[model samples]
Target: GEEVAQTPKHLVRGEGQKAKLYCAPIKGHSYVFWYQQVLKNEFKFLISFQNENVFDETGMPKERFSAKCLPNSPCSLEIQATKLEDSAVYFCASSQSGNTEAFFGQGTRLTVV
Candidate 1:
């Protein structure tokens, strides 16, 4: 069984500052996804990649938010300018494909002060 991994489990930044989140997809899994959780009951998919190529990005912001899943490297999700409203838990997930069940990492809790 494969599992997703994220770094900097918690992050705090001033409003208007930059915030970056790193994720290492599970070994052997090709699909990588990112999600933002603003509330306990809400999970918003941000973007997804299949083997270093973007597969779907329907929920991602056109600006500020960017992500990459390059080969041989840990995937990355960055917010160019963090706002107070951006304070939330960011989760990274991995799966074999879109149809497969996803395995999520312990979310990265980001706080914009």
Candidate 2:
């Protein structure tokens, strides 16, 4: 695919439940990034992968958030014990390399209640 494809445009989760999101990066792109948009203009980088390897995950919450990019599979971000603060629009982006411009998906909006 030429564009990043994200599944389940919207998700509603109860507090303490689990929420998982999927992202299929553009074919041939080697880098995939996951970001959370809490505020309308703020995008916080959570994790990034170079191919199937973890690149950087400094911004990801160590306890409740986990992500993976695997061979021949759509990348995923999973949140365990969902919290109200976890409600946000998650954007998946992909690029040929770290330095290239990224192409983003429409995003998955997660709402925790």
Q: Write model 2 residue lDDT over 1-113, tens digit each, in one string.
A: 99899988999999999999999999999999999999675999999999999999999998999999989999999999999999999999999988989999999999999
Lowest summed lDDT across 10 adjacent residues in model 2 is found at 35-44
Residue 30, model 1: lDDT of: 86
For every model shown, the clashing-pair count is: 0, 0
Tens digit per residue, CA lDDT, model 1, 37-109: 9967499989999899999999998688999988899999999888888899999999876679999999899
lDDT of 1 at 42: 95
- Candidate 2 runs further than 4 Å off: none
Candidate 1 at 54: error in angstroms?
A: 0.7
Output the number of the TM-score-best candidate: 2
